[model samples]
Target: MTSRVLIAVTHLLGVGHLARAAALARGLAAAGNEVTLISGGAPAPLVAMDGVRLVQLPPVHIVGTAFSALLGSDGAPAGDTIMEERRRLMMEAVAGLRPDVVITELFPFGRRVLADEFLALAGAARALVPRAAILSSVRDVLVVPSKPGRLEEAHARLLALYDGVLVHGDAAVLPLERSWPVAAEIAPLLHYTGYIDDRPVTPAGEGADGAGEIVVSGGGSAASLPLFRAALGAARSVAGHRWRLLVGRGVPEEAFAALAGEAPAHMTVERARADFPALLARAALSVSQAGYNTVIDIVRARVRAVVVPFEAGRETEQRLRAESLAEAGVWPFAVVPEAGLSAQALAQAVTQTLARPLPPGAAIDRDGVAASVALVACFAQARCRRFPALSRALDEVAAGGGSVALWWRDDDAVAPTPALDRLLSLAAKHALPVAIAAIPAHATQALADRLAGEPLASVLVHGLSHANHAPEGEKKAEFGPHRPLAALCKDAAEGLRRAGETFGAPLLPVFVPPWNRVSDDLAAQLAACGFAGLSAAGKATRPDARRARGLAIAHTHIDPIDWHGGGGLLPLAEIDDRAALAVRARAAAGGEIVLGLLTHHLAQDEATWAFCDDLLAFLLDHPAVVRADARRLFREAGEEEAWCAA
Candidate 1:
């Protein structure tokens, strides 16, 4: 089918995102979809290919996911004019060349300004294009949300607007739950298209003699010179092992030009190269920072190495990423806070890393890529199949008449652009009480003012200041009063009080953390602060699902459209739209038919929103279907049958 595809790319800085978009473009073309690569960040040097087309949008640099109304060359802002120009270019580009499928790179998954363009395109596609597939093609792992206040909620709005959220990370290496929020709800819509970089090579075929001993690397740019130097010094300090350092694109030649000649004979430094995966396949060991790209290379290479997490301000992205890999036993790793790192520490980490056994590089759910691809192909073909993926999702959402309280992260930072309308409407549709967390005083108060009359509107304690977690570690043991916990209890309460007093709406008793990874004392802490409830999800690691056991973390579960790495979106194979066909099959088997839907109010994208409307549209596509909200659902829900032991 000749479907017009608008492939959007918004890497903001790194080239990894554009690289993945280039790869996915390969598949969309093979499947005969008319794919256009919409350029957002630094324009990728064109890779010429037929069927795949490129349309450049004026590029804009994002400071930390928020649109920097200015560009930056050395991490410093350009002029505001640069941002305005990019915005104008994007709108003009979308308005002129209408597409059948507007495939966003990271808007809902990460970049959101594109979402504004997407909504406009979605409307045009729905009206004139008719069969346009609104899709989001994403790499695995979103830099874990670091926004302080409403910025979190602003992101979730992006996810609710898309048709399909295409995840490029293979679940074989990582589960979506390890990193993202509302993973279960987003699981069904997720696709693991494999790590979209470096094809695999067998070590048996390639001689190890030709390759070096161990490979150390930092991804593209933004390399931590201190971290890299420390790692190199550590390797050099060790006497015997052979090592090659892959300096990232971010590193300047001036920084390491002398390292090659000055280095201990055992260590060599080279510019960042693409064949690192090939190097990994033959190496005895590896060392690298935990950029998602680097992590994938090491995993795919299946080499055992020590990871030294980057020590930078609020970089929960690489720190948590490395820790997750370590927890999964992929490597023996260590972290160096940028504030206090040394060459000796790195050298010690390298020495120890060499001794550890290579973890069974994360298990790949073999068919996650195929499953994710199939969902996209089905949409590409515009085939309405049964949603077993959707049905199986509902299987876990126990039918209940209990009061279904809902929770989601919000920063009120992205500015209340019209981007939030559909999501708010959905909450309204369900009569769900929406909770915004981690909001700034003025932002939340303004939000309360804007939402004054809405019965569902309310604010909760999120954070005092919505900055990234202090690098020391912010993940509280479940219920612990940690950084955001205490900050939130103090500030969010004040913000709510100020807003409630001014706007006349009652504030809520929930303490919602920015990322929902609250510490152990948070619940008891919140209760002490007079909080009546707590809401968070995708973390099955927390204790007491029942508030009766502890104030419930959440009653109305959040459905995160897992697009980041294998974190939010499920292994696509697990999703079976065929289960919707099972509705027919369920009738035949005399079984109950229940359909489930979940959303992470954070990290929502254009395709996710479209997919939702499509799913509901599909549900409503036919007559004789009823969509019920959980309000008073426990009363109608069947009770668990118990048998007395005789």
Candidate 2:
């Protein structure tokens, strides 16, 4: 069935809100949904909402950050006539379409002025034959209301009208609670869909024309004149790199013309270019406002940026975003707050940003449009079957004060294969860290060199040799009781030493026995062999789970592979049941133990890969979960114990 969606958006000052909503509308349409976008704000110059039924209401705009006076299209202060007309048209659209989903952009939180229109629209949609799913679409940062009872009012409306809240930002970067005071009250309804990037970016290239140039920009330019002026002043002192300022279209043409005329001979000033993402890719440094669209563009371009936020009046949104974006680690961004925004400060920020290396493309979830549409569809259908079960499982784990930890144990890694490359690619896709269990005797120098370069990859000793030295009619065992105790210890010690020598610091001295069958006596010899941890399948039988020969004993709870059943992935139900049980165990244990996932890349089939892909994606997206390699797990354990002792 084709789902119909209605989106309501009103941008009073800047065009970012409309742009974001339009992008989502277009995305829903592309996903085979009939979409109608009702825009109440004035027509923006370049904003496009194609492929959707566009309905324009009486234009209204706010005068400055005061948001006190609403101006109409005729440039006169709007009265009840414009407000009543806007509400009427909005209501008419909702009543006509009776959409399956209703999305209101920034209502009740940031756009209190449009409460009448949105509230009425929500009420009408709810009264339809089939109640429409209502979603409150909000950006990462919201303007905290100063007036008393504002938050309570927003909370009340959300509790009453909205089915869910779609937060278009990565929670790891900026969660809803940073600026909004009622985050806890509405926690159950909020879903972070990562940052939305509407513009396509060109990959970073070498020796492009704009390389080594300082590129600066203001997102909409209404509040960016100061930043542009300060950038020009800073350019004069920074003599090494070429400086180019792309003034935004939101600045009055006369203002831009005046600034362009006063540009230094060494600097270039022009209106914002369509190739801004490409420009950032080639440029050595980026200077811009901390708007949502511009920040995502900078991150996509993977350039070092200095963000000078626009903080006019009581607007603290950009300032908060600047600081949080820098802290997010998706990219390198320096913040020059309005309090310290000057020629000297801009120059210093530019110099500092340039001193650092350009950051790599972020591994964040940038598929916000698709995720949002899925969420809307799920809520509309009143079914949880539309999305991944793993996602729901993660939400539960996060809500329960527990976390999921995943690690890969690829056995018999003598050299890299196309399959190994594919496995690592999947790991990178989910930003999941891996602990490669290398057979020390069979591990090649080339494999060690490759693992050395991967920042997220760590080396672990699989065994002295993968060869089984068991007696006749016995099961395969390398580090098992079948081997002599002294000889086995020597072999383990040699494997640890060789791995450390080959991979250097990247090698985490963790022993992963072949067949997951290490003898109890041999397990005690790990730390004496310089191993910091031992990872194996199944629960530990040791009474004291911590501090085994100065090593942490972490065992895998789920091995999706059905080893006895042709080495394919086990049934999803079985894997999930095992994982859930392990998570419950950890929660009962006060969240102290790490939940591990064991995998052998060499033995994986197509089904195995798919299971891993879905499973890891969910775990990495979870807020409470922390991805760690064997090295990080042991280090964190040591730190926690030290803290307890202190």
What is the C-alpha lDDT profile of model 1 across 36-58, one tens digit per residue?
77676665443334567776655
Stretches of candidate 1 exceeding 4 Å from the true structure: 44-51, 62-81, 84-98, 112-128, 143-160, 169-174, 183-194, 202-210, 256-266, 329-340, 357-362, 366-371, 383-646
Location of the lowest summed lDDT over 10 successive residues in candidate 1 = 637-646
How far off is model 2, as Cα RMSD?
Answer: 23.6
Model 2, TM vs. native: 0.58
Q: What TM-score do all the candidates reach, one by one?
A: 0.55, 0.58
Tell me how candidate 2 scores on lDDT: 0.76
lDDT of each: 0.53, 0.76
Candidate with best TM-score = 2
In candidate 2, which residue pairs clash? none
Candidate 2 lDDT over residue span 83-184, tens digit each: 899889988898788898999999878688777778889878865644677789999899877889888778767755666799998887688788886555
Q: What is the lDDT of residue 177 in candidate 1?
A: 53
Candidate 1's TM-score reads 0.55
